[model samples]
Target: MPARKIKLSTSSKVFYVICYTVVALMAIICLIPFILLISGSFTSEQFIRFHGYSLLPGEFSTEAYKIIFKTPQRIIRAYGVSIMITVIGTFLGLLLTSMTAYVISRKDFKYRNWFSFFFYFTTLFNGGMVSTYIFYIQYLNLKDSYLALILPMMFNVFYLLIMRTFVSSIPHALIEAAKIDGAGEWRIFFTIILPLLKSGLATIGLFLALGYWNDWYNAMLYLNTETKYPLQYMLYAIQQQTQALASIASQAGIQVQNLPSSSLKLAMAVVATGPIVIVYPFVQKYFVAGITIGSVKG
Candidate 1:
């Protein structure tokens, strides 16, 4: 027997067209800024100053990128530092978050609610910036340390809650069946829970990775050494120096030639954001699945 094909009504066809048109427009709106950013990055400083930004590069030049990569060694070092921090922080943070969520989500865990409340309460209130700075600097002795970048972003309560929701969705009978087969907590977690939590881990891991990769605030406060700067902070430092130079030159009644200020900002953004953008597509499926599954509560 041939399967029947369902045909859409006239109103349904019109509705579909409208939805597609709206979505396409929204996508283009979102994409326009990025297009302008790339175009501006490649545009020459003199042209940008005279003409402002355009949808496409009117005067193509790599001078901004050339100025950025002039000292290749420093750029490479910053890249290395950012990569190291992101990798280590994401791994540790994911592991700890999953473990904590698993423990809290277990029905038999005594004081689970109390612990959840404790974690939740922290989200609602904090010791403020002054106290946090003092605690990290004075007590933790993390000043000028790489740990300064990793530790602060390691355990987000929001990520913990999301992971907990994922863990809670797993059937208790499955866990009990594993226990009956003589699997200990560690064995069950490693063999069963971890494998099933792939989507959740990818989702939370992406958030953690992005946070660590883009963090310059912790660096500005705790890191005093130039050698310890991450990619983002290094770019930030470069921008600051360029602005300061222009300011000083102006005060001295001189025009700073070929400073590349406007285009340099655009170039810095491209450099800092390029790698993370590449990584997003690979984990996008898992990220979407995790968010959807974790949102539904039983």
Candidate 2:
């Protein structure tokens, strides 16, 4: 079969050109900084000191990476910690959030509105950081604990609302039919409701992963020992050490041997950002579809 072509008016043609132009420009705008970051990471420290950063390296060197990996054990351990927490947190958080949202989404469930309000209210008002910190430290005794890093991020109120809205849009008749089949609530939820929430699950899962991967605040507050530090916090500690070395060298009127200050910063940024950026492509299709469908009704 021949495809029918719909002709566009002159105005529509011009609009298409404008839209494409805007999108192309935006893509370049997002890409240029990353290009500079990669190039800067490879640049020699001395060259960067005199020439500043360039899109291409003034003189290429791997000393920055060498310095970062000089103590390979530390960096590798941090990487492991970060990866472990991110995986565990994302999986558990998604399960809890989806289950909670599913219950609230059901029309026949008594007191769903009250429970929804209870969850939603937390988003608007929360105890201040000081009190929460005290509670976690004193009551929970979570100091110097990995749970400190994971628990804070386990469930986000906003993500819960998104999940609830998406699940609510599923047909009532479908759920009724599931019940008529002698399927219990747990069975209906696990087998039927979950299968249909793929897009929403992908969207929420991505959000949870990013949150866990990039988390440094909780690590900073709760983690006292070096081995417990995640990658971001470890990188931060390295940056601080570099800065301290620079300061000491200046004070002693001596040259700091292999001060990777500039390149180290750029390299750290790349290392920290690289993995998570790779994740977006896998979820990109589900992300757009999920947000659009979930937000359509609510």
Candidate 3:
């Protein structure tokens, strides 16, 4: 009555071992850089200047982190701005993307194909950077606005298409049954479709969150106020200032000891990346499922 265990042939065992070895090696290779990054961030600036980065820290120090945290108020403000932008953008993006995808994926929608094409065409061609800047600044007057950061990344064409594919995979009969129960479009979407699209929502939401969190380009272009800078831009500004200080010191024949330039870069990365790394594990199952399902159909 017990299930029989399958026996592997010698060649099969060898093949299994090879596959496992290759995968393990690839995973370790990917992990090595991150390990070095963390190690280098804690390493003393003098040691790093004398010898390049290594897997382990040589003469451990927190000077890089100390330099970064010197302006604690600014760092906290930047963290707040980044967090607020990421949360709001991700929520709005997922809602808008899911709605658009659901509408387009409906079989009975009269102009679905034409609307899809219209969206797809924009991806192929766009107004150049000069025109876009003019429009955002001159026309929209979104200069120095948080919307500048959120709006550009909120509704990606590719994410919409992926959501559409997920929606299309749902059986039409389920939707029809909901309609038969006299449920309105809004009701059906909220009560039926939204619950069923958990994996898809999590996948797109994470992408939107990452985009908003990492965005510094739109901030540089649109924002003039130092108070409005996000975490990434704040780190970038600090790096620039450090480099400038080093340059001026060199020109004046004065050596700037303990500049922390190389180590500061690694420290900034650790700060920016720590939150996402913590959050990813929670949604990883949904992310993998959504990717698999979305890819199957399209």
Cα lDDT of model 2 overall? 0.84
Collision count for each candidate, in order: 0, 0, 0
How well is each residue in 1-298 modelled by candidate 1, as lDDT tens digits? 2332377788878888999999999999998998998999999988999999998999999977776676456678999999999999999999999999999899899988898889889978999999999999999999999999999999988888889877877898999999999999999998999999887887898878888989999999999998899999987886788664465335444566747778877887788888877887887776776567556642
TM-score of 2: 0.84
- Top-scoring candidate (lDDT): 1
Q: What is the lDDT of residue 220 in candidate 1?
A: 94
The most accurate candidate by TM-score is 2
Against the true structure, what is each candidate's TM-score?
Answer: 0.83, 0.84, 0.83
Candidate 2 on 162-273: residue-level lDDT in tens? 8887787799899899889999999999999999988788889887888888889999889899789999997777677866446534544446775767887888778878
How well does candidate 3 match the true structure in TM-score terms?
0.83
**In candidate 3, which residue ranges exceed 4 Å CA deviation?**
1-22, 243-259, 293-297
Clashes, model 3: 0
Q: What is the descending TM-score order? A: 2, 1, 3
Clashes in model 2: which pairs?
none
